[model samples]
Target: MNERMIRLADQSGRCDLHTHTQASDGMQPPAENVRLAREKGLAALAITDHDTVAGIAEALEAGKQYGITVVPGVEISTRAGGKDIHVLGYYVDPQHGLFLSRLAELRATRAQRNEAIILKLRNLGIDITLEKVVAGIGRELKPDESIGRPHIADELVRLGAAADMRDAFDKYLADGAAAFVLPPRITPEEACQWIIGAGGAPVLAHPGLYGDDELVRGIVERSAFRGIEVYHSDHGPAEEARYLAMAAEYGLVVTGGSDFHGARQGVIFHGDIGSVTVSVDVLGQLKS
Candidate 1:
């Protein structure tokens, strides 16, 4: 660890277990995100970009220069009870073919979904185009890699439809928003199995937000995942307490994270890695 990192750890500081970069739905690139993490004095971080490990290599390389350890991770969007749920996978082999194949399929689905969203928005008189979105993305993405809402949000900002990405999500992109379109998704149990099969620990990203403790528990009991996120920026104090207690009672590891997605998600960006205050020891426990 760097001196700044050690100091942050000594201060009862933060460690963000979840984040994204331009390689996924986030606005900032991985290298810039690492610089922000170092500036924020975060000790450890993970780049849990949606359904892909494309950002991990960049994050790991950047972390090395800044004295932070980057967890190889992904945030997979899956379904349960007709609602989308996010599963966080950490310390996985990026080359795991099972994980890679599933992600590839998801990315293809995401592309189809994005195209459909664009068509829907056009029909709704949004005056936006997919070409505009691709242009705003400003990077050459591989054919199989996913370009998501953030790219569209960027296009919206560029087109003067929204002041910023958050505005775009609020007015158009987020669930229930005007441009919202639900994509095909796998069940949470299936997602957890994929993560476990890839030799990673699968943790429920934010169970408190799911609002179905009984159902969530049912899935948890059936899956091989060993943990739940008990602390998060979007979670209330009461919710965190409840999740922590539930995790303890269920013999599940309790984790925390900031869920930072740069400016794309509206909240202020904390460190890309250290916004949750998770101890290194807690991260170590996941290895077992």
Candidate 2:
């Protein structure tokens, strides 16, 4: 963070514990995210990109240059009870061999899902393809980089099939939508195992988005979770209150974040960086 920006930040040193980068589906490069976090006067920001840690190295370097603490993190996509569950892992060893291998497998599954979505779109006369979406990305995806529904949504917007990413999800890519695909994947329990296996702190990310408190509670109550995202850009006061009480009930670390994924077609995915945050003291609890 810039000196003035950092100085202007909340006196308590606020941290946004969730975010994405181009290494995943986010539009910004890892360095750019750090720079923005600095400009926004955040004490720290986590690079919790989906299924990969490719962004962490760059973010860490940027963190050093900008004097910001960049938490190495990943958001693992899992399935349970017919729902998509996301588990956020913090302070992971980005170069862990088994972790990398497992993430590669998940990326392959994601690629397959992307292909299936493309096929479904084609069948519906949408005329979009995986090749086109990759080409539209303007650069080749690295081994650890990922492509998800957001990329497909961008292509749909380009093809005029949808006005924006939100519309694309509403009409086709979201769960239960026309092109939605729910392949059998690991459960949240397994995801917790994966995170803990990598010596990272696993946090249940944005529980309110799941819509089923029972399923959310199941993971929180049963998994080896270190924290709960009690504060999120998408969460209302009631949702925040519910999760805060749950965190207290379970003795879990209380965390918060903006879940920033950068702007897509002039719309920010979840939130802007620093829009929702918690005191940086939680970083210590997470590390412990």
Candidate 3:
């Protein structure tokens, strides 16, 4: 009966639990993401920017102005099985010193990866420099913000080194690409511990993307994750069904989101703000 009531209430509103903003690699500012959610009629949004909570303050302020709830979140990058993995933390205390310190450490790894990619591009005669990459961004990145591959990709295209972001990634930045690098980093278990320590709920993000159910299963089994992203822009019906079952088997809550990063030259990254969402009631579940 309780679950049925929750479902009935969810029909009235929804939340997008995954998104990015310029505080990380996204093109839009934090407040703009909130405004977009308002326009989309979403009851809530989460600013799960990469490795930084710097965007959360502005997003939280916008939530009040725009009449939407912003979930304080971060997408921590991790590595396992020779692949990149991301863990999303919701309701984390943005001011937690240890969490900030740990995120800074992760950002440092990202810097190393970026420099390695730049070196590889230079070796390939692309001639893009880290300084040039920062210059092309039109503004100085925040102290907590580090250069991401997408920014590098944009600089490459701006320099006519690549046709587009996709081209830039396919040839240089994506996994298995010539310039790709996966430096050593914390495990997903450690990330989960970070989130838990910061009084946040950790959720496994985009399980299907891993291409290794065993890895996903191991993380779910080993970590203190409270939820799984059963619905995502990249997930198909089959993938969703599989993860939905996985969530049920693990007694985990299901969260879904568009993973919005705004459009670039008429191309939206994963999807638009409301392209995929879950019942707004799920927000309460995450908080609990």
Model 2, stretches more than 4 Å misplaced?
1-12
| Model 1 bad stretches (over 4 Å) | 1-14, 142-144, 162-167, 264-273
Cα error of candidate 2 at position 152, Å: 0.3
Residue-by-residue lDDT tens digits, candidate 1, 60-139: 89999998878888889988875678899988889898789999999989989999889888887878888878776778
lDDT of 2 by residue, 177-270 (tens): 9999987688788888888889899999999999999988887877899999988889887898899899999999988888899998888979
Is 2 or 3 the stronger prediction by TM-score?
Answer: 2
**Please, what is the TM-score per model?**
0.88, 0.95, 0.95
What lDDT does model 1 reach? 0.79
lDDT for 64 in candidate 3 is 99
* Residue pairs of candidate 1 with colliding backbone atoms: 14-277, 15-274, 15-277, 16-273, 16-274, 16-275, 45-273
Supply every candidate's count of residue pairs whose N, Cα or C atoms clash at under 3 angstroms.
Answer: 7, 1, 0
Residue 14's lDDT in candidate 3 = 80
Give the lowest summed-lDDT range of ten residues in model 1. 3-12
Lowest-sum lDDT 10-residue window in model 2 = 2-11
Candidate 3, residue 189: the lDDT equals 90
